[model samples]
Target: MSRKLLNISIPVISVLLGLLAGAVIMLVSGYDPIQGYSAMLSGIFGDEYYLGETVRQITPYILAGLAVAFAFRTGLFNIGVEGQLIVGWIAAVWVGTEFDFPKVIHLPLAVLAGAAAGAFWAFIPGLLKAKYRVHEVIVTIMLNYTALHVTNYLIVNVLSDKQDKTENIAETASLRSVLFENLTDLSRMHWGIIIALICAIFMWFILEKTTTGFELKAVGFNQHASEYAGMSVKRNIILSMVISGAFAGLAGAMEGLGTFGYAAIKGGFTGVGFDGIAVALLGGNAAIGVVLAAALFGGLKNGALNMPLEAGVPNEIVDIVIALIIFFVASSYFIRWIISRLSKKGAK
Candidate 1:
């Protein structure tokens, strides 16, 4: 009972500390923290449109968070989710634009293309790690740049129009839903949120109810022990990366098929992958936790835009708060210590 309570209390305390620290910063800067917070809440929940937009924004974050969390649970660091997402986006766009098929066939094919492209891109690093003992972090980081340039080259030389963006995907290949639009008061929210939720459930099931999951987690906990126990650590590593990249790729599909119906040439990283790390960490790398954490992040990001307009606070202050939250989350040892001390005092 105490363990479960501690698990819950630690994150809650960390969040409160982060918010308190942010309030202090705002006070020091001569801004009203209460007003800023009130505006932020209102912006997030003011109407159906804002709520829908927040959900839409969180759709990708949830998938990306799951990707990172899945890898983390398997004792791997997948920093290349951004690269996988890029390649997946291009692949989805390519399929959506080039294919002529029925809505059912085309949409699924485009989504699959995105997932396969992401898996393939991640496979390279996984293979290198398995065969040559290469560090996945270094390989994935470098691959991010490689994926960016390669996707850009393909867009410029092969897939793009005069405007440096891919042609709009066919409507039949889109995941947008008029019904959802009407329900959300004309926000960009789409059927992709359904897919994201399904993926979260799928991730939870895979991790909690499967023999393969047990082996993967065993390998993660102790590779040597897992190997001695007849588990294949190398195989698990490669498989973990592949699955992680697939989730990230699905996130890319949400952008291509739902948000934009086209792929734009990017100047740099999308930052979604980087944000996934924070999401995974704050969520304790658990599947359900990732969903909740992603929603919070999505709300913050959606609400930040209104801070300056409605509350006379700089939007960048939200970024500072987010950074501080990450800091507090990373310093979880301190929070745990405090909790332990409190528990001991109560027992005494």
Candidate 2:
């Protein structure tokens, strides 16, 4: 098969295999796999409310996947999306609640604040990686812990005046749509999905259609050669991380301004940032692919809630299925070999 067809087929096959494996697991665990999957599908698409909720979940997944995919394109491993998103959540809420600007200015400014905060957080690791040869993964991993505590402290000590959450953002900064809510039977869907789609397009344009993109890809392919060709490898590394973090921050903004309309202290990691790694891997790190992967993830996540209710199966099985899918995607090399062997046998 052509590389393009192979790229598409791998993910599709992985997803199918994952579902099959999940069914096997369900059978072993004494649950009706068919009923479980049927309920899952029903929860995701059988009702307008669930469909809207799935789209709402998808919005942030798209941005998070874009963040990881963008970094991968430039040969960067940004493990700090969680931290970047944490700071962005607070930063956006701060601007949203503190400002009295008009809707047009307030909403845009709040969103920009989130993007800027994430960029700044990501910049630290980028700068260190470029100048000191420090590994970004280590630095970003450490920063996630720091961000969690700091944001929690800020929430209790500053933003919320000893509360665990901040106040609701101003009406001007809210991304809520009453019309959409009514249409979906009060689901949390918002226009953030539009923003996520736009950002996906932006990533594609920058990486595939721009001079900067060429330089970034060149650096990713070979930094030493890129530098010899006069492309500043250091600059591209920093730029890539910054852009990736901006997308991550926008993911936080979707939650803060769209779904929750506020920021809250968390007892643990949000998981969305980490899940982005899987989405990017499963999507082959391409913009369109990422969007599709995000939708699948969203559907599974939203639909998982119904598994126990209708099929007497634990919802955690969905997570297992997702993990299986990601595992298969990551093992694409082995799968390719298997396919190649099968094809040769068929030809013989």
Candidate 3:
């Protein structure tokens, strides 16, 4: 359908425009645009090491993207993923330290603790929205602060070590590396990628093939109508938020249990939760789309480090390019016009 073509065209055009804009900026800054782009390309796909890092970076983005996309499907703006992630990270770390279980049990238990904590954090906003008619946007946004401060306080006072970080988690609590250390030769790629991919597929199935997913979508489209039709609007809203938070929590668990091998206190809020908004938008709120979008973002982010060295361009150009791409994609009127013109030409 033309409509589908337009949807695809818009993003493709936006990306081209972003690259062109980046070139312009590079010229203005007295840098070689060609070299800059070449560097970025090489950094991502040139070697197995960089490729592995790209995958590593994509792992969290996938979960974060899913968190935001899931909320979008439910017509809720869950801006509290940062809060949920922080709580998840803290809970995971705490459990890792306090318990002494075998490897199989301990790892899963700590990850589950993180998910439970994140779900609890999300439940607050969900409850308020369902019971008191509170706006989810406001509640979730404010909860980000609550999570940040509470986690910070706990880390500083209770979890802090002599060096200001909690002790490293035992091997039992960590996910065994699949390819990071020796196998990958210093690359950070790990089994988390597989888990993230599985989660994405699971979400796609739930959203596209399940009865509960339809109910949630129905509530999202028209809560009042759903209520009249005997569907419990309140319950669906709460569940959606809780599930959204759980995905974010898994992102945190990936960081703590898979990447960091322990939780380190964040001196301030990490922006991964907020960045998830951009990821969701770029992904078009689809599970597969989110995975691809996350991979693109991860490449840009990871490759930025190598740009300065190889291209003599500032890494900040990647940020600018991303912003432009998002702006153009969001404002798709131009893309529609272009597609319309092309279609008319073909007809002629």
Instruction: List runs of model 2 lying over 4 Å from the truth.
Output: none
TM-scores of all predicted structures: 0.98, 0.98, 0.95
**Candidate 3 ranges with C-alpha deviation above 4 Å:** 176-178
lDDT of 2 by residue, 1-348 (tens): 667777798999999999999999999999999999999999999888999999999998999999999999899999888888888888999999999999999999999999998899999999999999999999999998998999999989988878889999999999989989999999999999999999999999999999999999899899999999999989999999899999999998888999999989899999988988888998899999999999999999999999999999999999999999999998999888888787789889
lDDT by residue for model 3 over 206-266, one digit each (tens)?
A: 8899999998999999998999999999999999999899889988888777777666656
Q: How much lDDT does candidate 1 score? A: 0.89
Runs of candidate 1 exceeding 4 Å displacement: none
lDDT per residue for candidate 1 within 1-348, as digits (tens), equals 288887877677777888898889999999999999888887799899888899899999998999999999998999999999999999999999998999989999999999899898889888998889899999999999999999988988889654679899999889989998998899999888888889899888888999988888888899999999999889998998999999999989998899889988789999888898888888889998899889988998899888888889998888888888899888888988887887789889
Number of the top lDDT candidate: 2
**Candidate 2, lDDT over the whole model:** 0.93
Model 1 reaches what TM-score against the true structure? 0.98
Ranking by lDDT: 2, 1, 3
**Residue 30 of model 2, lDDT score:** 100
lDDT of 3 at 51: 86
Model 3: worst 10 consecutive residues (lDDT sum): 175-184
